[model samples]
Target: MTYCVGMMLDRGLVLMSDTRTNSGVDNISTFRKMYHWELPGERIITIMTAGNLATTQAVISQLEERNKAPSERHNSLLEAPTMFKVASIVGNLLQDIIEERATDNGQKAAAGTFSASMIVAGQIKGMEPRLFLIYPEGNFIEASFDTPFFQIGETKYGRPILIRGYERDMSFESAIKLMTVSFDSTLKANLSVGLPLDLLVIERDHFTPRHERRIEASDPYFAAVSTSWSEALRNALDGLPDYRMDPAVKEILG
Candidate 1:
């Protein structure tokens, strides 16, 4: 299991993902689930993945290989004309990989063992920044005014925070803070989604990342945000009006 989120804001985009991957409680490992490709002043693309590790790795590797080899320019992420086309290319590659894996193993296509999903966010020269949620079936949906964020993997635990706090016009700092709270909530509820977390922030019209970092277990900012969020939740709960017994029930009991 893992947790990955891509948030669309007026400023640009913010993406974060957990590093923990586990076969069991005793066989956990850390693997990066966030990747980015860039062509300075032309375009920048970021992808956060969740699901079968092998399938995700295969998809990423193929993209990287195509990116490096000039002969594969037709399918290269760097050569994609628009963010929408880039999302389509990635979705198709992801779906094909899962299907190929399933068939090679003599199982039905997209069997549970070979399924994965991705969030693709990026901007191309002369185009608006876009974000997409790509599923294992080669179809995807873009983020818009109605749905400005996408979450994949172990999503239930952290979605409430995003739903309650996200704003389309919020500043980048506020967005990152909100994401930290969301990730902290999930970390407390699920062991399969542990840190260190990879974070990438892409500013509007900027073909490169505005900020990128990995938040380790001991990162002061992360620790402070986690502690602060926990305290805030408790205080909010305490401040809410308490439940009272019905007068009729009290009289009957008396």
Candidate 2:
């Protein structure tokens, strides 16, 4: 399992993903789940994948090959005129790859054994920044004002922080901080999701990544944030009012 989040804000976009994958308790490995494509001053796209490792890797490999071909291909993400088109291409590719794998494996392989999902986020020149959650069925939905962020894979453990703190106009710094806090909660709650996170930030209209960092287990800043968040939660709980029983009920019980 893995966790990836993409936020669309007034400042641009923020994306983060964990690098953990495991088939069983004894079979664990780390693989970078975030893939980026940029055509400086023209377009930028970042995709964070989760689910069946084989399906996701194959989808990314095909996309990369098309993008690197000598001639621009219509299916290439870089050739898409708008972010919406880019998403369509990706979704279709994912669906195709998954179906092909299933076909080769014969009829008994279970319907969703190799299912995967992706979070696509970035900007295309002349268009507003966008974020999308692409599912295994080749369908996707974009983030709106009411839902300014999208999270895929192992999402339940960390959704509360985003729901409580996300703002449309938050500064990039604040967005990144909020993301880290949410990720910390997941890290503590799930052994399947571990350290060495990939972080990327895109400034509005820049058509390129503004901030990028690989946060390892030993990163000082992440360590500080994790500690601070735990302390804050403890303090908040301590400050809450305790339950009080009615005097009559207390006397009766006594």
Candidate 3:
């Protein structure tokens, strides 16, 4: 299990994912879950994946290979004319992989053993920024004005803060700050979701990443944000009005 979030904003798109994967409590490892392909001024595509490691890696490797050598077997992410088509191709590929794995595993292939999903975000030269949450079944939904973000994997523990604070017009910097806090909440609540975090930003019409980075356990900014959020929560709790019995009602009852 892992956590990945992508936000669509008026300025651009912001994406984040944790780098932890585990087969068991003792068999944990770090693997990058975010991927991107860019053609400088032409297009930029990013994918953050969650689920079975083998399935996601296989999907990514196949995409990378196709991108390197354009083939009739599949449409390369680079060759897709629109972001919508790019997502369709990716979703189809993921579905094919899982189905193949099930066939190979025969009756032994239980549910979710070879399942995965992705958050796809990017832009083409003339198109606006777009975001999609692709499911394991090769279907997807685009982010809209009413829903400006998508989250994949161990989601419940971190969703509340995003719901309360997200704004579609927020700056990229502020968006990243919000994302970090979201990850912080997940990290504290779930052992399956751990650092380091990969972050990427694509500004409107740039056709290239505006910001990309990885935040490790020792990252000072993340450390400070985590500390500050804890303090803020405590302060908020303290400031809330407490419930008390009405004095007149208590006296009348007595």
| C-alpha local distance difference test of each model | 0.92, 0.91, 0.92
All candidates in order of lDDT, best leading: 3, 1, 2
In terms of lDDT, model 1 sits at 0.92
RMSD of each: 3.1, 3.1, 3.0
Deviation in angstroms for 250 in model 2? 12
* Superposition TM-score, candidate 2 onto the true structure: 0.92
Give the Å error, residue 197, model 2: 0.2
lDDT of 1 by residue, 18-130 (tens): 99999889999999999998888889999999999999999988887755666654437888778888899999999999988888887764488899999999999899999
**What is the TM-score of candidate 1?**
0.92
Residue pairs that clash (backbone atoms under 3 angstroms), model 1: none
Q: Which stretches of candidate 1 lie over 4 Å from their true place?
A: 66-75, 246-254
Which has the better TM-score: candidate 2, or candidate 3? 3
Tally clashes: model 3: 0
Task: Point out the higher-scoring one by lDDT: 1 or 2.
Answer: 1
What would the per-residue lDDT of candidate 2 be over residues 1-254, giving only the tens digit for each residue?
Answer: 89999998988999999999999968999999998989999889999999999999999888877556557444378888888998999999999988888878874665588899999998988889999999999999999888888898899999999999998889999999999999999999999998999999999999888999999999999999999998899998899965558887666666
Q: What is the clash count of model 2?
A: 0
lDDT at 135, model 1: 98
lDDT of 2 at 106: 75
Badly placed stretches (over 4 Å) of model 3 are 66-75, 246-254
Instruction: Give the range of the ten consecutive residues with the poorest summed lDDT in model 3.
Output: 66-75
